[model samples]
Target chain A: MRTAAAIAALSALLAVFPFLATAPWVMTIALFTLMYAALASAWNLVGGYAGYPSLGHAAFFGLGAYTEALWFNHHGIGAGLTPFAVLPLVGLAVAAAGLPVAWIAMRTRADVFAIVTITLLFVAQTLAYNLRGITHGAQGVAMPVPDFAPATFERPFYYAMLALLVLALLLSHAVLRSRLGLALLAIRADEDKARGVGVPVGTAKLGAFALSVGITGMAGGVWAYYLSFIYPQFAVDPLVTVAMVLMVFLGGRGTLWGPVLGAFIVAPAQQYLAYQYGASQLYLLGYAALLVLVMLVLPRGVLPTLGDRYRSRQRRARTLRADVGTGVSADTGGDIAADVAGEQP
Target chain B: MSAPLLEVRGLARRFGGVAALDDCSLTVRRSTVTGLIGPNGSGKTTLFNVVTGYLRADAGQILLEGRRVARPDPARLYRRGLCRTFQQPRVFADLSVLENLLIASGRRRAALAGPRVRADDRDRAEALLAEFSLAGLADDPAEELSYGQRKLLEFAALLMSSPSLVLLDEPTAGVNPTMVRTMERHIRARHAAGTAFLVVEHDMNLVMRLCDPVVVMAGGRVIAQGPPGDVQADPLVLDAYLGG
Candidate 1:
């Protein structure tokens, strides 16, 4: 009951936020934050839950952007379909490219898997830079703008980004409740044990990797359309990958709300700080300092850290009651009683 | 007594020059509890690891029922009705105790696909937790449990799979006396239900209490095998232990 109420309240707030945003800056910041949230949530599927730290989501993101931008620029197929209409195919293309790499990389464990992803990122960036005919050889491409009133262009993109973020959030929530989600968590905790328990670890991981990159690809497509321009460096930036991972870690890696919380906090701070300082180095330095501080104070990330403190306090109270020799133990129960008081689904 | 459920034939595993399992062989009969006993570094754990697919045998074949299972791997072995607990409990520490059991259950794949936990599976998980005296702590993160409780969780999780063959690597090692009794009882109950066991243990008293057709190992070889009384009386087995 409480969860439903909370969800409804959150929905109400999100639905009304645009109306409350009187300034253009607020809308721009919201759009950027939502985009980060989508990317981070997508990363959470593999990196956070499956326990594969992929440093190469930028590959999929850049590829997705490139796919749409290239189609809009040269294909002449845009007359019947908007660039947004091609997002799913772009996502599929990215996922297809990601699948083989994820399959090979997942055979390894820990940091080695991360290295494989980093290799993919470099390979992608190199391809975008060198593939002169297709990618325009670092000259970048300008997306043909759709005819819209000048004042209304940003509003549509803002809502589109918001829809993407919501979709990502829902997808993450569903995965968490699925058998694959459970398997991923088991793998994260202990891969050998997970396999011993009958989880098809390799197959499950590849599926997660494909799903993660697919969502990231769609987000990238949306971002490219919003920008109306794409360059190899801007599309495939390593820093974009770094920021996505940083936000995941800062918010809470495995928890559903962690990435969203991180995006809401970190993304706007990053944009605002960069706007105020005008130097990328200052914002990067601030992000680094904040990450170090989070590591020191809340090593488990924000949501989990807070959850731990809350559960510990509850335990203390329960312990006191038990020590007093009460006839009833507050802890005894079935799943329903337990589920009600535990973390929201 | 019955046809062997699992047969390890001429199994040999080596690390560099050291033969961890040197042509070792053993059999686990259907519905029987078989014990693998050896001193430290005596290749007992190595043999277990090889059979359970954690370590690949250098030269050997593992036969389940009557068919050869080549190039053993944990997931494949598990789907073929083989499950195991580790020496130190390897429960999914981040998950709740109930969740640990649920993931190990056959319903994991379906649950993953549907994104829903079956009511019956949840009920079974709860029942297993209660039977193991861990029902109260069912929702607690597995790592928060005491070392002994973790062992119980691992054992409970193995049982949740309804495995035909269970390879318990010291199921009672770190657990208390009550837990040892509970585990022994659970093993016997499961054995009567037609499951087979190949247990590796250092606790002779527990071994004598539970296992039949005892197999003793020394220096990467099976030194003797017989009824518990006969194996206990074997001079070679005594010498292997006492270094006589």
Candidate 2:
């Protein structure tokens, strides 16, 4: 009930923020934040939980964007809200495409898996550059501008992206709480042991990979439709995958809200830095500095650290209770003091 | 007494020029605690790995319940009711102890759908935790456990699967006496309940006390196999232990 209330309040705040902001740039930043939050959460499913750092998500993202772009172009959905309708199907198609890739990539592990996925990004970028007939080469695909008034232009996209974020969050929560979640967590700890214990390691990981990329593709479709124009450069950027990874690492990996918090923190800083120093590309300097800072300070990331501390305190209390039952002495005045202090809510 | 639960026939596995397991044949009868004891470099661990499907055998066949297993994928073998614990206990360190138990599959046969943890699984996990004296740490992550505790946790997890043949690798090697006692009690209890165990331990005392039809390996081959008293008195066994 408490979680439900928190979620309801957060949703309400997100839904109402655009109306009050009014500025075009603010709404743009807001939309991008939501998009990154959703993308990072999706990435967390496989990368964080299964301990598979999939750098190939950028390719899936590009495919989703291009699929939507090509669909809109072919159907001639002229600058209207109709492109939003097929986002789910776009997600499914890209997820299906992800299976064969997962089948191959998941065979190797750790650095090898990363290597395979990195190859995917380059291969995808090369294809996008060379596939002139479908992707229109490097010229880019342009969507007809939406016919909405300037006052209400970003609202639809913002709301759409918010819905995607909510969907991603809910899915992350569900997966974490289920048996698949247990399997993924086990795989993350020790893949060999996970298999030895009958985890169905391959199938569980594949399912997570598919779900992760599927959600990412949906986000890409929405992002493409919102941006109104996408070239290979921006659509399939490897840096995009890095950004999501950074968000997850910054907030906390494998925790539900970590990616969301990381995305919320990162996307705005990125947008603001780009807005300020994008021409010089000096914003990258700040990003690199921030990356170092994150590593130095929160190596395990935020949620896990805080969670460990909280659970440690809980463990202490429970152990104390068990000790009391076993007729063990408190040992010290400080120990009793600390126990009482920790026991308080 | 009954049929052989696990039969590894003339199994040979090599690494480069070294043959870790050379024509090692062994049979673990149903409902028996069969100990595989040898020196540090003996092929006991290698044989365990090969039979449990962690490593492929160079030549030979393994039959579980009369059906020959061609490919020994660990998960597949586990669903076929074979489970193994490592020398260094491999508990899910990040998960709660209860979760560690819950994560191990409880079914002997493969299910069409995912085997989500059932209510009975929870009940059994709790019962096992109390039995193992780990009830106080059920909500704690396994990483917080002591080395002996981790070994106990690993044994509890293997028990969760209701394994037909459990291959235990040095289950009580470094554990304290109390923990070792708890482990032996559980092993005996489980064996009495009709589960078979193939244990690899360095402790001669434990092997003699707990195992019947003990199999001793030396230089990657089974040099001796018989009842505990018979194997203990064998000249080859004496040579393997004291000379080689």
lDDT score for candidate 2 against the true structure: 0.88
Native-referenced TM-scores of chain A, all candidate models: 0.90, 0.92
Clashing pairs in 2: none
Q: What's the CA error at residue B1 for candidate 1, in Å?
A: 10
Interface DockQ of candidate 2: 0.46
Q: What is the C-alpha local distance difference test score of each model?
A: 0.84, 0.88
CA deviation > 4 Å runs, candidate 1: A79-81, A317-345, B1-3, B108-111
- Per-residue CA lDDT of model 1 for B158-221, tens digit only, reads 7777789999999888778987887788888888888888999989998998899899998898
Residue range with the least summed lDDT across 10 consecutive positions in model 2 chain A: A330-339
Instruction: Tell me the tens digit of each residue's lDDT in model 1 across A112-156.
Output: 988988888988999999999889867887787766556555676
The estimated TM-scores of all candidates read: 0.92, 0.93
